[model samples]
Target: MAKRIGITGNIMADQSGPFPGYNRAYVNNDYIQSAAEAGGVPFILPVIQETELLKEQVSQVDGIILSGGQDIDPLLYGEEPLQALRKTFPDRDAYEKELIQTAIAMEKPILAICRGMHMLNVTFGGTLYQDLSHASFAEIKHDQEKDPPLKTHHVSFEKGTRLHSLFGDSARVNSFHHQIIKETASTFKAAAYAKDGVIEAIERTGELFVVGVQWHPEMLTKKHEDMKKLFSLFMDAVGT
Candidate 1:
């Protein structure tokens, strides 16, 4: 049977006017395409607050993809918002964080993208830089680089780690993030890092199929086979 993958959707940027006033919102196509490429059935899981409703979302899907979105509020990691940081989305934050936690509790496999990756880190007691203005030794331009053909940066995967197992020792990936993993929580292990020691990828340890990447893997899925490897591995785990 084809596996069911519940992808976390990016919040539609709707601030100028009243929301559609609908309960079941829709996810983007990138998530749906990625999951379909990974040989799994894709389902869009809308953002909802009721804690009990989470189980129903988890019950239908064997895995999830926490798609990228706006930067996480610095308050989440006990840090004040920096001047360079852009606007923050509280409702989106609340929904994704709770959705992720609920998914984790279900023991369903999850693959978190850029902001999604950071979200996983914070959920497990981790911290983020919030923004990259005065941080020393910062070299990577993770947020915006339109000149280059692809949207990625160099990342060094740790040896003997799950990320290394899936994509080998090193690879360049899309880097559409300014905030990054700072002090990671205990539940996750640093699997990959930027050239300047910024955490790029992480995995939940001790018998869980939780993986997160600080890049837009969904963007690279069409051309970068390694990105597909990341998704295939996650789907494969879900099958097990």
Candidate 2:
């Protein structure tokens, strides 16, 4: 059977549509397409606060894709909102925090991307820069205004990391995130880093196949073979 991949979604307020002022749960189509292309059944798990409902949602999927969205609430990591901090949805943060904990408890594989990566880090006792401007070491342009599929900067993988196994020592990736991992969780390892020392990827130390990438690989999979392999690796882990 093809793996069932649950993608965490974001809540958007309908501004002028039929349901004006109402909220809608959505995940980007690229994430759905990426999961399907990787040979998994994709399901968008809407943002909800009910703990039992969240557990039931995770119970139905073989793995989880923590999809990208708004900035993580700074309070999640015990910090006040900085001047450069962007918009955030605390309810979504609460939902994903529980989702990740439930997924880990069930030993489900996870592939976190962009903002999802930020959530994963916070969930694991790590912190984020909030905005690249806060990190003096992050000299490169991380939030590129170019087309989503275009590569913007280079990243080097650690020798023994899964990223290195897939892309060797170095690879160029399209970056679209303003926040970067400031400190990785104790249980996870930084797998790849940008030329400016920003973390590009992270993975749990154990064998549960949890990984997070700072870039939007879902947007690159269609044009980059390496990106496709990254998704395939996650699918393989889900299958196991």
Candidate 3:
């Protein structure tokens, strides 16, 4: 059987109308395509309210991938979002958060991208930069020009970490956000970092394999060998 990969959809509203409608719910194609191209099945899950429904949806999948999108509600981490901060999707956030927590407890493999990484951090008592200049913006450009999602910069890996073992040495990936990882949570270990000293990737400390990348590897999965390696690694972990 093919490895199953359940991805969290993005919560976005279509502002094309005079009044924004209920279009703030969708998943990224790259996220789906990456899994398919890597010999895994891609499953896009919409934001749901009922925890039982969310749990049942994830129960059938072999792995979970959280894609990039809007900022998480600061209230989740115990704070108020600033003027520059983007509001999170309450339904989407609730669904994915519970999905991730449950998935982890179930010992399922998880791969989080961009904002998804931020969500993972916040879920574990970690905090974010909130805004690029909230503290310092000397860091590399968070949003990339080439890929716009996660195909734009190079980052260094911390030696002897899960990310290091997955994609060894130095790696350049796409960047696409203004926020960066600030407070490292006890549940994770810093894996890779940007030249500006920003945390670029993190791995769950125990039970199951969860690696969250600040960049979007899915955007380059077809053309990039290491990117392909990522999904393969995650799928491998899933079957185990």
Alpha-carbon RMSD, each predicted model: 2.7, 0.9, 2.3
Residue lDDT tens for model 3, 1-240: 778888887656677777576566577677888888888888888788888888888888988998888888888888888888876676677877888899887778998988889889988899887888885744678776564444567899998887788778889787778888889888998899888888989998876889899888888786788889988888888877
TM-score of each model, in listed order: 0.90, 0.98, 0.91
Query: Which sequence of candidate numbers ranks them by TM-score, best first?
Result: 2, 3, 1
Looking at candidate 2, the ten consecutive residues that score lowest on lDDT are: 17-26
Better of 2 and 3 by lDDT: 2
Pairs with steric clashes in candidate 2: none
What's the C-alpha lDDT at position 45 in model 1? Answer: 82
On the 0 to 100 scale, the lDDT of residue 106 in model 3 is 76
Error in Å for residue 102 of model 1: 2.0
Candidate 2 residue spans exceeding 4 A from truth: none
Instruction: Please give, for residues 181-219, the per-residue lDDT of candidate 1 as tens digits.
Output: 778889989999888888888989877788888878777
For each candidate in the order shown, give its overall lDDT on alpha carbons. 0.80, 0.93, 0.82
lDDT-superior candidate, 1 or 2: 2
- Return the top candidate by lDDT: 2
Candidates sorted by lDDT, best first: 2, 3, 1
| Deviation (Å) of 200 in candidate 2 | 0.7
